[model samples]
Target: MKRIVVLLAFALTSCSYFEKQVPNEQELLQKELKAINWNQVDEYPSIAECEKLTDATQRKQCFFEFLSSTIQQKLDTDTLSVLYPELDTIEVKITVNPDATLVFEPQFPQDSTAYDKKKIDSILRVRLTDLPKINPAIKRGIPVKTQFILPVIIRGE
Candidate 1:
């Protein structure tokens, strides 16, 4: 019984020693363990940086320019199905009020689904304009609070 107790104590102590090599309070407090600054000091480039271009048309073009063609196609398909249904195109008019609130208009074909109008507008506002880089140009009216039309084809049928 004494030998067993000694063995168990030794095991517990060694286990702690090994665990001490892992992340503990000391490592967490050290400067070497600082959290990532994703913007300035990381390889993972932000979408805003990727989309930066000289003009609105070029900026829109940049949205399609991705390092991976597969991801681009996926984004295109997802965008089509999510933003357009029962229509081959969509016209988005985002008007910025003098008070800085946005007004969204999603114009669909006459035969399009009776999608929740406010919901559709909300989705565009949150997903497109609310992006960190997209807001400034939109607010400043560089692209201007105006109409933007893009084609969308229903996938697989």
Candidate 2:
């Protein structure tokens, strides 16, 4: 009985010597990152004019509205209307670069004759260049490039 007790005590004492392994700095950092909420952004990127707004939702809305209106104003649909009076709609995607540069890409049409891309891009580039510098998107307070999908509706009336 005394031998069994000594063996059990020795086993229990040995267990204490086998300390739990500690994770490395990288592993700890990875665990912390995994615990973070990626879906939530503390603040959104906004134009200089909208920097004053504190609410994230309002700031985002203001940014989008301002961008859309500016693009709409720059669109010279007058000539296009004359060419294709029945032209209905054109889909385009705009990407905002980290440096606040604007890139417009018009969706290619299945029928070539149905639209003119080079002319549209030239006009777009000129207009975009003439406009003021835009603000880039923000993720975790860092500037990030973002894309905006827009539909350009062309109507004669």
> Each model's TM-score, in the order given?
0.31, 0.68
lDDT: worst 10-residue window of model 1:
37-46
- lDDT value, candidate 1, whole model: 0.46
| Model 1 Cα RMSD, 1 decimal | 17.3
Question: How many collisions between residues are there in candidate 2?
Answer: 0
lDDT of 1 at 75: 34
Model 1 TM-score, all chains together: 0.31
What are the runs in model 2 whose C-alpha is more than 4 Å off? 1-22, 32-42, 76-78, 109-113, 155-157
Q: How far off is residue 145 in model 1, in Å?
A: 4.6
